[model samples]
Target: MMILVFERVIVSLDLENGLYQEFSHPLYDYEPANRITLGVLRDCLCTFSSSEKFSDVWIMKEYGNVESWTKLLCVPQMGGCGCYIYTKPLYISEDDQVLTYFFKMGKFSLAVYDSIHDTLKIPAIQNNIHDLVPEAYLPEIYFESLISHFSQD
Candidate 1:
């Protein structure tokens, strides 16, 4: 299994035998090690890195292969939203649209990024709670289970 350690190095661990080896990607060379965020996209290991000017998303097309790392998306840091202090990719639609969560300057928002056209869109969401604090809210993806809740006899 692939795991990201504190120093921004990717480590492969063999849980069955308790052995692990560390590896580094060239993408980590240019960016600050602490700013890199590791995640999974399309069932593959992925990473998100950001700078003051842009944010990049990378996917490892083949597991355990350093050369298989491919840049999936690069989003420019645009106006209004300001530079993203934090970015988390939540989902990717069939049309190559990426649903991402971003937090900046005490506000959190969701944006849909179209890789085909290189565009970003913020969807309109209705907020019912007037006392909601942005810092108190955290967004996450929910996976539905196929197994029924009833006990098997």
Candidate 2:
């Protein structure tokens, strides 16, 4: 099994024997290594890259195969403002809409991209209490716990 690690380059770490090897692809070579963010989309290792005008999402269809890398989607920068620094994919729905979190001009928000229509939708999320807003947000996939929190004793 390969565990993806992001260092100066993408590395595959072998857990059993503790070996490290770089994961390389011709498509990834064009961008600076630091600009690439490793993630898992649809259970496959994926990379997110943002340029001045667009953000790209790439996925490796087959694990440990460099040739399996495929460009999944290219999302244009919202509003053509050129202020977005990063766009990270959070989830993909069964209907093929992609949910992404983006940072622009020091603020972070979520947007959904429809691949079928090539449209980006920024939904309004609000927190009524000003003090509850976080300075930064890191989204992750989480499962609801079935076990009760109350002590049995």
Candidate 3:
């Protein structure tokens, strides 16, 4: 039972007095795939965070501010029935701390951030894995998205 609390991270742009807008959030009452809304906002940079984990999370410009940015369109490997390959890589913003946790649980887990070193190529993780986190843990993707939704304000 992995969980993902999408944090509202502000990407610091090269522009002066840069501010962050809502990055990722929870998709309550939406389709299964919509459970998590993960992506990079174009045209700006700032910090983002979810209250559930790594409260101080931020997504700084890894390279430099461009005319546009990317947002990873990712989901648990098990839930990629409708995911597009073109947008898959973008979904994984290494700066997204939320992915660091859930991906530790399953094979299709963690499209971006990785907790265990050498965990690069999606290792085989069984669905509903509990070895990493406690049994009563919150669903990784949803929780993280929800948290990101809440704190982005």
Per-model tally of clashing residue pairs: 0, 0, 33
Off by over 4 Å in 1: 1-7, 81-83, 127-131, 142-153
Q: Model 1: clashing residue pairs?
A: none
Q: After superposition, how far is residue 62 of candidate 1 from its true place, in Å?
A: 0.9
Model 3 Cα lDDT, one tens digit per residue, 1-153: 999875433243323346544333322222333223233332223222222212122222442433234332222333332212212222234453233433332322333434333123433557644455543453332222211223354
Sorted on TM-score, best first, the list reads: 1, 2, 3
Candidate 3 Cα errors over 4 Å, as ranges? 1-34, 37-69, 72-129, 136-153
CA-lDDT, candidates in order: 0.71, 0.70, 0.32
lDDT of 1 by residue, 1-153 (tens): 999765557877765569987756646426554667777777777788877777777888877677889987776676555636547788877787888877656677888888898777877789812127776666766654222356698
What is candidate 2's lDDT per residue for 46-93, written digit by digit as tens? 888877667788888877787899998777777664336555888877
TM values, all candidates? 0.73, 0.72, 0.21
Q: What 10-residue stretch in candidate 2 is worst by lDDT? A: 128-137
- Residue pairs in steric clash, candidate 2? none
Best by lDDT: 1
Worst 10 residues of 3 by lDDT: 81-90
RMSD to the true structure for each prediction, in A, is 7.1, 8.7, 14.0
Return the TM-score for candidate 2, rounded to 2 decimals.
Answer: 0.72
